[model samples]
Target: MSVAELKERHMAATETLNSLRERLKERRLQLLDTDVAGYARAQGKTAVALGPMDLVCCRILQGHTGKVYSLDWTPEKNRIVSASQDGRLIVWNALTSQKTHAIKLPCAWVMTCAFSPTGQSVACGGLDSICSIFNLSSPLDKDGNIPVSRTLTGHKGYVSACQYLPDDDSRLITASGDQTCVLWDISTGLRASVFGGEFQSGHTADVLSVSINGANSRVFVSGSCDGTARLWDMRVASRAVRTFHGHDGDVNSVRFFPDGNRFGSGSDDGTCRLFDIRTGHQLQVYPHPQDNSTPTVTSIAFSVSGRLLFAGYSNGDCFVWDTLLAEVVLNLGSLQNSHEGRVSCLGLSADGSALCTGSYDTSLKIWAFGGHRTVI
Candidate 1:
């Protein structure tokens, strides 16, 4: 090769190298600068104060006496309900964080629970392969007391996730270990439709999680052990709106942003992805550290402020990533002595006033959010 050609190639290589270095440094800054708890320390110990991980944990609801599997907050924000291995659903006051009610179930273990959009009832799905709904308010005495509602069954395996159609409390949907997602007429306790015909349905394997887009009430998404996430329209007949295929491992979670056009997924492959729902094109892929260490992404949440994304990893560490720049916001901390074991679930209030996490440690931890929100 001529000297001139060799020199040109070298310059191109140098430019590429410099660009990559700049991106790496940004990830590092995301790791350091975005640390939520670290910045809180700079301020006095108050509304925005707590020990790195330990102090941040508030009101461990200790009633299950077993691993808490699923939980949901009432739409009114007045109560939160949790399902556990003990086969019970316990209700708590949202503010005081005090237990208010508990109900024993006929099932073996409860896998999922959800609140009706109006906050008047709740549904619990379990290993017994049935979904149960309860009324938050019923024929009260002279004062005011809630009553047990009814049970809806049909799935043959464990129910993984249950979501109610947006703006409607009379209907609901659930994804299951039976490899199908079902829509139910909650008012009549009848199956409205069996999604995904009968051949192990749309998902390649057991469906793990499901989330509905509130902006477009008729659409929802689900992720599965088979390594893909599918979007379905409630108005259609088991037709997949989009199928996302890129993860090298099982997909555990999928959710839509409040805006409704885009969604995100987290997998056992140690990566979180954001995609455009219309064209089935992946817009961006956010990766875990190169160590990729243990490869289990426990939980993920979009900050209420829309400025950040939070994910809990298998190694007991949590990270915050900025959504706009696709940068890491901070390394929250490890679960070590904090939650007991891996963090399995996280919840953020509608107003984004507080955060809650459930883990194998058999407890729930709540974190206070204190970030400034600006319209972008």
Candidate 2:
């Protein structure tokens, strides 16, 4: 080999290293920054557009065989868990972009999977009507393990979402198509309180989504097929703290601002509405560009600073909006790396530095957040 060529290569390598070192010096979370590895191509697709000015695809992790219905990155962003219609729960090592384990469940078409606040456990729910928790501390977890720590049995219908309460690591809340949301004491392994009646009136149809207030352990908001979103302050345990009406169609999702003064809802009517918690009055409504003709807004999340809103649409797109001015800062149209179907779910980490998206196309995509995004 020529010495000049070798010297040139050596110089190139050193330059790349120096550039990366400068970039890493400014990392926000001390996170393991790894680019995603899978480009899920379609049968006859020539090109994919993931938005130009904004929403660049940093990485794509593809492993699910069926529609990747739900996925979430653990608090530390080191591990990710995804559920698919193939009746499998797959956990991945987010850093190396490798599959860690495949958890086989009783049936196919699972809906959601969530990690505990401590990242020590995981819970999954689906069409099977039962929620199961897996302990990550077991030896099996790191070796492609499939251990069911406990099967939480109770719901009469599909369990949509199960999440650990923020203040308590041992407490969980599960919402179901059975028209109810149940709170369970994780340590005691018993139902703590049912929001359906004991604490608040149950929805007439399916309870589609549920979210807890970041500042209050006893407060939460639930959306239902009945076209209403209700705030349940279990601190009272007798009735809803407030009931709100605005959406003309079924409310598909609900999420609270970090401060707990307001909340947001996504509805089938193709609008994401923000409302005042104290007055039960609509504070703002971000509707579809097509004016009710666009796809449904499936999920909505707030930036840790509570100034930005990220909304996922059924038309296979995502939009980043400003909370204060109600303006879309970026309309990340159809992901260049899209699912064969719709993007069913997306989650931003607690600090708002990472975004995890899952879709019927059977894939998960993660995006890095900027500056933890506090109050705009």
Candidate 3:
């Protein structure tokens, strides 16, 4: 190596370090001069100032060998549960990037998983048509498998999604390919009520997603391949209160708005729609550009403030939409180190600080806002 070239490189490194040190000094000075709480209050008033495009790829959680189909962040925002086609359910400590539990499933085709509201347990189901619950606090069996505390088996088809009721782990809702959504009594492992499947009150195709109302727990909604979303009441499970229609393709995912007065649905048609539960009106529609082909919308989640909508696409793209503007605010797929295969599912941490996306690439990526750093 030439001495001149080495000296040039050394000078460049030194210049970069000095630049960084200057920036740090400026930041420290700004912190010292600013009113911290007032600044924080101002920041909190604007929910999510930085869009997904502004977010750096903070963590790529790699472990699953096959496509990760589903993931859920516990309400505590400290843990995540993911179910993969590799026949495993992984419980992750979100802060530390450590696996707390890696359970071997009895079946390999697992589709969905959800953590209880209290974060005490996890439930998952798939092509086996069974909803299995695992007590996270229980000791593992000698084989290192977490023993299943109960298995609810009444679904006639693959269980597509499962979620515990808000503030109540004793009950859960499960959507199925059988065109029905069931409310289950988790304590007894019995069916509480079947929400659909009858000629007059159910989806004509598979029920793909369900979202229980956070405000009024008795009411919940389901999205279906029938291209419709139905609102149902737990007290009257035999019939739907309203049937929402607009999508031309299968409704793949559904999620309640933070207020619970309305819900959103993502469809294979590459559009996400919002519907009002009371008026039964189609409130808004978010569609991909007409200039290019669209990818199927695989999953959707709402930010805690309901100001943003996160939609995962089959082409490995995750779009963040401004709820008020109804336009794509950011495309995570265009970013470096983004998912390489179809994005199968996505979810937001309870605190709304982190967004998680799972993909056919057999990995998950956690994206956080400007100041938060997830433990590696």
Best by TM-score: 3
How far off is residue 159 in model 1, in Å?
0.6
TM-score of each: 0.78, 0.80, 0.84
Q: After superposition, how far is residue 30 of candidate 1 from its true place, in Å?
A: 28
The superposed Cα distance between candidate 3 and the true structure at residue 40, in angstroms, equals: 27
lDDT of each: 0.72, 0.76, 0.87
Model 1 residue pairs with clashes: 30-328, 34-329
RMSD of each predicted structure: 11.5, 22.0, 20.1
Model 1: how far residue 248 lies from native, Å: 1.3
Model 3 regions more than 4 Å off: 1-53, 290-292, 371-376
Residue 376, model 1: lDDT of 16
Model 1, 102-211: lDDT tens digits are 77676747888888888777888877788888786556545443445776788877888898887788899998998888899988888887766463337768888888
Model 3 — which ten-residue stretch has the worst lDDT? Answer: 31-40
Q: Order the candidates by lDDT, highest first.
A: 3, 2, 1
Per-residue lDDT for 1-376 in model 2, tens only? 9999999999999999878855754442233232111111223322222234245556678888888877776878688888998888888886676887778776686888888878878888988888888887766646455677777887888998887897467888988998888888777677878777333366777888888887786789999998889888766556667777768888987988888988999999989988778755676778778754689988888878776788888888788876665667766555465445577888876556667778887888876633433223
Q: What is the lDDT of candidate 3?
A: 0.87
Off by over 4 Å in 1: 1-58, 138-148, 199-201, 290-292, 335-337, 371-376
